[model samples]
Target chain A: MTVDSRSEKTRPDRAAATRDRILDAAERLFAERGVLAVSNRQIGEAAGQGNNSVVGYHFGGRSELVLAILRRHAVAVEQLRTDLLTRVHPGSALHDWVGCLVRPLPAHLAELGDQSWHARFLAQASNEPTLRAVIRADAKASPSLRRAQEGMFRLLPAVPAEVRAERGEMSRLVVVHMCAEYERALQNGVAPPSRTWETAAARLVDAVVGLWLAPVTPAVLGPDAALRCRR
Target chain B: MTVDSRSEKTRPDRAAATRDRILDAAERLFAERGVLAVSNRQIGEAAGQGNNSVVGYHFGGRSELVLAILRRHAVAVEQLRTDLLTRVHPGSALHDWVGCLVRPLPAHLAELGDQSWHARFLAQASNEPTLRAVIRADAKASPSLRRAQEGMFRLLPAVPAEVRAERGEMSRLVVVHMCAEYERALQNGVAPPSRTWETAAARLVDAVVGLWLAPVTPAVLGPDAALRCRR
Candidate 1:
């Protein structure tokens, strides 16, 4: 019933480092092999630990390890959300908001941000059921995420609670798809005709913005209105 | 290297029950564990085939097995889409299209549709990378899907290619969120508050459609006036 003394014996600084290493290794492997395919032993080995005990020692188990990885990165992810909200003007084009949301990752990768791998891994985890709960829980618990949501709620006063939740879900998906696709593009070395990472980011932002900003006008309801006929 | 005799042995009459068994097991497992996590042997065993070769003999392999499940439920899925599209009156509401796309799974389950599990599995696969390609390839090969796409293209003629693609991606994420939430709800046996599912679906569709159908009344801006918003 007591906390594991074996885990507590390690110095706090060293323990933190080991935990980071395990998380780093785990995210990379999860990104490459998926949550189910990656084993605790493999994660420990990747972290330079001698045995599978690290997974249990540092975290309770594989599931907990996944949560830790997500928890660690939830800060950066939430900050990205805040950054977008800050950039939106009351009258700004909807796409501008979309651009603000979509443009960050490649921009970071180009600048060589420390958490690029973690970002990519988190994006992948967004869809994974075994790992998705961890990501959602971490995201929900993030102060930055809370602040961002609050800001969005303030900006979208007219949007219903249910609508806000739905919009939030779409926002998450847009980020996941953009990040995952960007990573795949890098892996394939297919420099999208855009030429620069920033350019690629801009294109993504444009496409996202166009989709989000394009349909805000009130529609005259009719049998075929759902089909989105041209104005 | 050679085509297996099993392929020849799978005449339409003998294959119906076997194919259904394969699909039922594959869809359930894929929903529980992704395509990579569910092995051929596991699928064969679950399908009640004595030999592990049933997956290959019946559906090619793991990837093909995933595609087979998609194809098996293609009719039901498409019917759902058509039903939703038809529900939108001339202009009754465009935002409902988003709900139409997402709400039907729960409705299908409520109605005791035969392929509800497969729909849930496909919803999960929509967010997965390994299965995305398989599903996309199958969609490309499916005449019904192409016909549906053409039908949509004709209706939304003003939607740019890139915009269409982005919306499609966004739609996938919407489905993923709904499916993931539904799965958790089912696991917990919690019925979301009445109107919760429909409300959530409507809210998401509003954001998606709002951004796409933004009402910019193009005032007969002499070319110069029209150019004002270009930047």
Candidate 2:
């Protein structure tokens, strides 16, 4: 009787552990050092793997490695959103949906405790237009995210298509960079006004909701069209 | 006569022309490639200088080069803000103050036209936590900016101090990134709904004003103070 002789070195659990180690190392390196500066070999060494090509073998290229890192956090963040979404009723106010959108990220980071690199990783990646696509793709998987976005748009006033698009960009930019700043402040022992994650999220939610619902000037909307837009 | 060798090379016109050329090349390269990724040699070559050390000799290092580029635009944008300030009254509405904050940026970009790299350059530098200090320093030199920020803060609602600081970060992030995205969209020939810079500025001003004035959630504002904080 021939037993399956696959090596223990290639065991499923071992491979999974290896992937996680590489991801953890890569994230730290990418966060502290700029993403473009740190390399696959450095990541392998950081992960304690003697093989230089382990990173490439597991994650392919820098972009895919980046995507993998994003996927790791995104899963947890999405789960948070899913859990948050269950608490949000269908007829909940815009803030409820906005909360679902905003809270999960900070909550997840807070749970990660100190020395968390996910926020900085996100900040660095999102700043680069090309790299931001990976994040967007990962985010698209979350049903809760899609629903929250839909909820916001459904409640949105008749903004010019351009204005809506631009504000959407602004909202995302705020979320991405603000968290990075908060994380930096925490690491540097600089106490910001919103001391806790809860308060920070609250501040963000208020500003973002206001940003979405802010009145467009009559001149830009055109007085007649602006009146039509109001209702 | 041994009278002033290299005098032609040291001419003010030659130096000014060289500085402008280097700035142009650095801005384009930094915008297309990241500020960190591009080397001084590459910038010097791009500027048509034969000596590799020309960039370093002319502008010190990457940080100084970046600062010089920022100073170039800050002067123009500050002038624009100062000019706009002359029209703003002591009791101008929040949107008016926000306008002073928003308009100078897009208006300057619009004038720089298709090949403008200033917005993207700002976005890239501002995203890097350390690099942002240079921008803050340049911004401090603008009396109009200080006045506009103070005006907005004075008009602000009963926000928690921490919330105020967090939102301030959000506003700067949004401004830096939104302009980069807008510039990209324009470059890619993506005709957004807001066709003109004028309309885009109007939209940005409205949203930013709303963001500043958005109500803080009572829960986060704490129970004892929620009532007092409420409008």
Candidate 3:
């Protein structure tokens, strides 16, 4: 190969390796420390970069860096969800659909083993005001996630749209926080409630299915009642 | 009174006021930023203290500062729960007991008005590895919370202990996060899913009742199944 072509081929390879290293360091630091607590300078130091500006150069800003971390795992998680969806059908039970919603993330974490920081990292990101919308929008963009939500909604036609939306948010919280807690437990050498990710996912599916299938209680008090009661 | 005695009494009043200021500043900063992200120096400056060591003098450490913030709200929350429990008899429905569990925090937040930071503060603390245990231990120490849990357990005679424990954690996550999200929405001028904290608590009660009452699905896979499946 010509000198120019050889250098061009190796340059992209080196850049990709550096990107991966930075991502790994950022994820672990963000997970261990709070997301907003850890600075880009710290991330660069952790990634073994001599230049403090390396994080900004690669990712532009914190929000972009968080999104890149999320998108890195999104592909594998989306594929897992899509794979699970293939087994689901129009007549499948609500439990099966809930499985599609809950399993993919934990399954991905399980593959990462004890050293994985994705769950905790996402948990931190979800609580940050600036980053929360980013995470939600990313989830909204997922075709497999959309399919899973649709599958669940189809199974519960009688549920009100608002209640469904509310329960959907609850399910997301439970899965993310529970997995984060489980990840912390494992890393701390403390016993987690469930023995493995599959079992933890199973427990989550049960509770989430219950959350979705639970009867909606109509608001007994008018909107003004709460205000009146407060006064 | 003697001049020395009068000065002694006034000094305590001044110290008490300083402590409250420090707590208020720390809570708001921690809520807006992540818990670990905000430092003692920032908290002192926000509280209008000229000396950075004031936080160290009053609260000692980050964990203690977090606990002090939690304790500040715990009294009002406990009182609210106690009053709610007075109306709840042993024969009261599970929903009533769930109300005791869910309503107190939201009710307390309602009393604090739009500017309250307790929910968001707790949400931030709960996600932090070091502070999470402090919050959990504080919750475990509450008499009213213990009563509410026992009341629910009485109604749920058939559920396994582990399942109950898992559901309790789920309940805590839902309450903390949903209220945090609602508070953020209200502050941002975005419409929340519920109109008021009272109404929000009502929605939470409905979902948590379902969570606690939901049937547990026993594990179909062995402990080794997850490990084996990975291969």
Candidate 1, residue A214: the lDDT equals 30
> How many steric overlaps are in each model, in order?
27, 2, 0
lDDT (10s digit) by residue, model 3, range A1-231:
457887888998999999999999999999888788999999999999999899999999889999999989998999888988988898999888888889999989988888899999989888987898899998999999999888988897487666777788899899999999889888888855446787788889888887877777676467575553322
Model 1, span A1-231: residue lDDT tens: 899887788778788999899888988887765576677888899999997688888898766877887667455545555566675665665445554455445544544433356545766566566576766776677664565344434444364444445455666666666666666666667634433444445545544443433333232345543332211
TM-score of each: 0.72, 0.88, 0.95
Per-prediction DockQ: 0.16, 0.45, 0.53
- Candidate 2 Cα RMSD (Å): 5.0
Query: How much is the TM-score of the A chain of model 2?
Result: 0.86
Worst 10 residues of 2 chain A by lDDT: A222-231
Compose the digit string of candidate 3's lDDT tens values, residues B140-189. 99999999889988997587666677788999999999999888778787
Cand. 1 TM to true fold: 0.72
Evaluated against the true structure, the overall lDDT of model 1 is 0.59
> How accurate locally is residue A41 in candidate 1, as Cα lDDT from 0 to 100?
88
Stretches off by above 4 angstroms in model 3 are A1-5, A192-194, A227-231, B1-6, B192-194, B227-231
Comparing 2 with 3 on DockQ, the higher-scoring candidate is 3
* i-RMS for every candidate: 10.0, 7.7, 3.2
Q: Candidate 3, A189: how far from true, in Å?
A: 2.3
